[model samples]
Target: MRKNVGFHSVRSFSDRRWLLPFLASLLVSFTLFMATIFGLFSSQNVGDSLSLDIVSFTTLDDFENDSIGTDRKKLLDQPAIMQEEAPRIAYLITGTKGDSQRMRRTLQAIYHPRNQYILHLDLEAPPRERIDLTMYVKGDPLFSQVENVRVIAKANLVTYKGPTMIACTLHAISILLKESLRWDWFINLSASDYPLMTQDDILHGLSSLPRNLNFIEHSPISGWKLTQRARPIIVDPGLYLSKKFEVFTTTERRELPTSFKLYTGSAWVMLTRSFLEYCIWGWENLPRILLMYYANFISSPEGYFHTVICNSNEFKNTSISHDLHYISWGYPPKQHPLYLSTKDFNRMVKSGMPFARKFAKGDPVLDKIDRELLGRANGQFTPGGWCNQTSSDEMAEQCSSRGDDSKFLPGPGAERLQQLMKKLMSQEFRNGSCSSLQYDQTKRDWITPKKPA
Candidate 1:
């Protein structure tokens, strides 16, 4: 009986020891499982609160109930808004010695509050002449009030046939881009150039057109003259010298380039702001490369922009084959176009060109254009919607006071310009743009149409 009792007590003690350990392990596991579930619920509550806070801060009441997919679809379906107002032009009016007055006249003729103007008198002009021009620009009440006219304080020494002319043009364009953020096109003119239409007419005519068009008369470099132009290397002294000098040729000649084809065109051009930006910024290396290559080429102004535009795929299709200037050349042509006169007035009026070039200083024909086409008198601005008067007495003194520049009063000149633009934008002209290699046969050897006999 004693042995049996001792054995039972030992067995019971061993079983109790194991049973206690098992109970402790079970209790620990249950506590961990409860903690994990509480942690998950706490995290979910915090996430919901953060989402609510973001929604409340942004105040997107309309979109609170919208799904992300629905919002994206709505945004995709919305149409893009476009500007409907008349486009603004940036003008660079350049001149040499004794051209200050002509430059001012041209500026006044083309003046509009909406347009930006930069007048450059080349370094060849005396300091007195430049100062006189600055004084004239500052002294005018209208110019001062509008503050759209600017005179380049530091002028460039420009050789008309050299790359310096192109440099000056790029300089002016850079200034225009910096000063005004809204101009659509850039038009370059010389002191000898004159406007054939009122600013109102021009603004109205340009308002309906695509902003990407660039009016540059270009053709491929070809024939015997191509060898004459391409083979001989020339250096322009105007790049470094303060005084004017002709370009000198080197004895060594170079082979024509195999990489890119060469093109030539009229120096007078009306270019889109976007295209000029591409040239000026040179995001691609083509503009800079061509600029360096043409540094030694004769008549670089006529070819630098021409080559860059035609070679660039981005702008080649955008080129138009016209320079939009009315210039009369003698048959078989001279170094310059014939000096325009009253004899050419009727022809100039009928040509539907907005501008003409190579007019002599104080030409009588300018007065006829001012009187008949522009409706301007008494040395005032060209009459337009900006400043027109109904009174007969006020008609003589119109544009003397400020008026609404946003309004456009297009007239017979607008109709004429529209006709010309229509023809230039037709399918035939577009199909041949930058696609042909016609050689320039006119004097100056640039691509320009001969005056109709």
Candidate 2:
């Protein structure tokens, strides 16, 4: 009788264990059902509040108007966005034979301790000139102290009309990328280029911009020049030759590329570090493919970056459609732009462009610019807020010593640049970015064929 009673007790406990778990599961299900019903009802209430009928008490137009005005006022009251530190620029100044002095002058005019500079005297320059350039860059006290200046040791045989020029530019960019990662933008300039503003003004103006913008004046390659540029098969001997040589054309003509459209633009460019990284690193294959395609293309410098940037979905919208340099061309245009002189100074200034190109080496207009616009005395670096010499009496020795590089005292130049930037960022400018048909039309008009008279 005792054994049977113990067995019955164990069976009863086991049954009760199952009952508890079942009841707990039932409770959880009930809780979830209740929560779902509550959520549904709350959503219905929100929907009702948003309905058109609710606007009877407060007219929809009136509410919208009030909200829009309030939002605008709030946006206006918000603090302006600014960078925590002054932006740094990386400059690649290229030159050929007989450009040593001019390159040095341009370097000093644009030099700032906060920026990095790389000088490339191409293989066309004699060994003595290259040595002299290297010595000058190394001998400068400020450059030695700051260690921001570098010279390309292995000079490239660059052909301006061939892919070699683009290769040289890329080589310099690679060096800059490896040397310092702090610079925000990379600006490419020839020895013929000169700055119209001080580094302080540039930094001040650029501080307000998004860092990813690329300034490259670009349009599609079409019309009269299309057959000339795209159909020819040319070989650039600079790629394999130890000495410079002109590009030679083959007898065979090929069809225009069906894989990708061709684009052309000014060779001069100011590109962002991120976009350059994308080009150099090339996690995507577009940059590499276009590079190979342009290897045989004439004047690759004019088209390589333009084609790459416009074709890239990632970087197309980031293009600003301006080269940021003031250049003058003839009515019908020519292979080379007309050399700028004193006569063009007023127009150059009025244009509000920061840099101008193809200035004759040591032109009097450069002196005028240095005197009036840059305030840089003979053989002195451009004066900036970073220099302690403020008095006119010390003009001769200004920029010899350093002050607070972090501070900037921008003048009229900065205001002009700001105005230009506002215009570039306007709705009109935004609408014109990477327009396929519009670019083709512009190219057609630019190189319109004359009637056979």
Q: What lDDT does the true structure give each of the candidates?
A: 0.82, 0.82
RMSD of 2: 12.3
Worst 10 residues of 2 by lDDT: 437-446
Residue-wise C-alpha lDDT for candidate 2, range 318-432, written one tens digit per residue: 6878899999996799989989999999988888788998899788999999998898888889888888776976854867788888888798889878888777765456455
TM-score, cand. 2: 0.77
Q: Give the residue spans of candidate 1 off by over 4 A.
A: 1-82, 388-392, 435-453
lDDT score for residue 221 of model 1: 89
| Model 2, residue pairs in steric clash | none
TM-score of each: 0.77, 0.77
Instruction: Show where candidate 2 strays beyond 4 Å.
Output: 1-82, 435-453
Clashes of each: 0, 0
Q: What is the lDDT of residue 328 in candidate 2?
A: 94
